[model samples]
Target: MGVLSICFVSFVILFLISLILFTIGMNFLFNDYTIFIEWELVSLNSSSIVMTFLLDWMSLIFMSFVLLISSLVIYYSSEYMFGDIFINRFIMLVLLFVLSMMLLIISPNLISILLGWDGLGLVSYCLVIYFQNEKSYNAGMLTALSNRIGDVALLLSIAWMLNYGSWNYIFYLQTMSGDLEMSVIGGLVMLAAMTKSAQIPFSSWLPAAMAAPTPVSALVHSSTLVTAGVYLLIRFNILLVDTWAGQFLLVGSGLTMFMAGLGANFEFDLKKIIALSTLSQLGLMMSILSMGFYDLAFFHLLTHALFKALLFMCAGAIIHNMNNFQDIRYMGGLSIHMPFTSSCFNVANFALCGMPFLAGFYSSDLILEVVSQSYINMFSFFLYFFSTGLTVCYSLRLAYYSMTGELHSGALNVLNDEGWVMLRGMMGLLIMSIIGGSLLSWLIFPTPYMICLPSYLKLLTLVVCLLGGFMGYLISSVKLYFFNKSLIYYKLSWFLGSMWFMPYISTYGLISNSLVLGGTVYKSMDQGWSEFIGAQNLYMNLVNMSKYVSSVQNNNLKIYLMFFVFWIIILVSMMIFV
Candidate 1:
């Protein structure tokens, strides 16, 4: 422990303080209470811009959760990052990230939100590239640029809000409801949320971001960065309900959820599999929120944050011991060598599958029950249930291959579970994963939802869990020739193993195509044919007209007088004839 460790300790203190404040805020929830702090910046004629902070139960509680995960991540990193030259630098960036999240939580005005939003993007880019390697650099670019799309969308939302004569959108949620301008704002905001949350087209960057340090991934993927969009939707759910935008969300987020789940089943890289799980969980939150269940989405967000952070931490510990090996095929029987991490991993996998009263069960179980009660289309119903089923499928697969299979990482590796600092971090979150659901369910939903789901729907989770477990055992234990299949089958495996080619389309296809098209337009039109027909032709015409004028200007007074005399004679003759 050194100065860097001490700084992490200091941040841990700050997080505790924020948590206490949030706890205190719960007393004011029923009063419809909000605390607003503001300072006027400048006045432009009728409009005055001011910096404002809005503190409510929602913001405070969410901030508390974010801080809690961040503080744990910092503490965990003290050992994970121990003895590194730039450990202090990494800690500082994380602290800055926490600050940005807090700022985002408190802001009421879009301008203030931008301050935090942009801060998150910039700091995330810095953290993702902290390793200073080519892979990290490329991943950082993809992460930053993908998120920039949302930042731009947010800015456009702010621009659109200018038409309403205010930046405080909270006041206009109901007052300006159904206004065309507001619908446009809602659409833009939804687009922004999609990009931030890695829904649909923006999905590639989430898993790619696993190139960052594990602690960073634990914080970013599990809680802060991905959930930011879901949180924004929760805040704006009033405007989203009963809108076409919400339906679009239902579809996009559904596809994202199922896609990520399928991708996780194919992925073998340790961190990336977990990363895809995060993407899938993100999709789940977004999809549920789209159905007008904001509180359920938020509940799952917090609970998911607890277990997923623990999951990443466990993965980090295992990776740390394995000498940076991320392929689970190269790992097995890890529970024998690293019991604590293995236990944490197994518990997280169970919780993720929504087993009984684990943290994930409270929210995910509720999502399934509520979704079953609704009059959803078959497509939505299948996406939701199948995605939920797939969660169990992949999680069971991960647990089987990584924890119980024959050891393939070699016998002389000298792996040990003696990293107490890492184990301490996992212990904190493991307890939460085990019991956080019951506690959060009591706290957030004091009056539990009375679900009227059918018997078949009630059995759906169990059926899925059993089937997923059996399939996982079959896939891992049996010698399937998935690799030696025919070319047709091989192509199908490649398609899914590559995340439905989304990474290719979004990264290489979208970017390369945009650049190539832009270059073509610049050469063939802007610089070539358009130049010939536009500026060049106009310049030539202007020059020829000027030459004719100059030619007519030579000794112009005598010619002008002769013309004037001839016109006067003609006018006089016409007057005489009249």
Candidate 2:
């Protein structure tokens, strides 16, 4: 507790200094000056590997945000994890996670970036399993292996970029833009990003990772870990903007967004619901970035970080108060007990639903407007609109069950809206969540986006949002008495609750198939025919030959010599005949 308390203050102070420095540097972007800190690690006559760190406005702004959120998370944990013996380990892991993110942000070189990328994956795995429970172990394996796919893809991208004769990808992103080798590299990078960002086929891990401590979830899902992919794409936007892979990303991100909204509606775990919302937002960011809105995506990335981290902090407070209870069915009318936390949670939820004037609206509204005006197909349009509606739907449902509904239990409360350290952390983000969006828009885009759309399309978001919110409230308002009542739609409800069976697909479908195939191969080759013919049969034949030689031994020298001379004559005759 003492050490974490000290770390909380130390980290907050350090990142505040960084935020000031980076804000000043943002004014100097027009100077054509970049600070490059480079050192040679491996050198040869023909080729060499070097670690290069590039600092520009983009890197500075991102690093500053990462440090800020990370510091707040540390401060929040000072109380969230108050009496845990491993609190020191937790703080150190978080600091290491921040360092990895900083490394990823500043390094333009692919090899140097790997150090950060792999570190994020490793540290995240550690964080996910910090509780050392069975659920945490499973979640940790899923998180680590899924991210490992991206790490492998990145290594492949590096190998493909070797044709440029250097691992310094930043130096070649422009010159090799249209080159075939670079195209392959760009495609691989997109694949890597998909896995990291929790897009389809690699998406279940994001929600499952909620088995981790809430602070870890807040950090991993919000700014540092998942956002790494979007930041990577932003850096490599020059390469992806004109490729087939970009189109692939657009379609996939749309699906991911739609899926997240759909999943959150049926989810009951408070933290998992928030995790799903994060996934939906990630999908939005990836889709827009694919459409060449690099700055827009980056803007949302920043604002989302501000609120999502706060949202998790709010959830952490609730969970702590409830003695680690998470099911929303077990909670209701909590705002009456924990006013400060409930207010922050609702504000973050409103921001998540893109309420006007809040942090989510600036970027989300712009993204929708841009999609509405762009030459996108009808399928993409429907995805964006319906996903938006579902966001409202699920949020309303969450707010009802967790904040405004009748109390479901009679448990005594230990504390309410009174964790001063925790409340301070939430307040820090509360200030940002209120004005961060519009403020960032002013800074990042001096000119407002001129959205030209029919009044009908412009109101589409509002209409769908209302309908979804009404549906959420209406559904929650109805109580189903099911003690002896069989649900006819039980299967349908189960499907939606199970994230369209994604966990089943990723866990049983893919993993079981691989294991079954591996077992088949092992049985047929390793333990069966191959083992017998290669080793067992050879040993048996050698033993038989040895037995025959041993049985032919003689006791007398003369008899042995007579038999040896006869056998030699017969052997020489047979050899001559052959």
Predicted structure with the largest lDDT when compared to the true one: 2
Each model's RMSD to truth, in Å? 6.8, 4.2
Model 2 alpha-carbon drift over 4 Å, by segment: 29-33, 42-48, 479-486, 515-578
Q: How close to the true structure is residue 129 of candidate 2, measured as C-alpha lDDT?
A: 91
Which pairs, if any, clash in model 1? none
TM-score of 1: 0.87
**lDDT at 152 for candidate 1?**
93
- Poorly placed runs, candidate 1 (over 4 Å): 30-32, 41-48, 479-488, 515-578
Candidate 2 clashes between residue pairs 3 or more apart in a chain or in different chains: none
Top-scoring candidate (TM-score) = 2
How many backbone clashes are present in model 1?
0
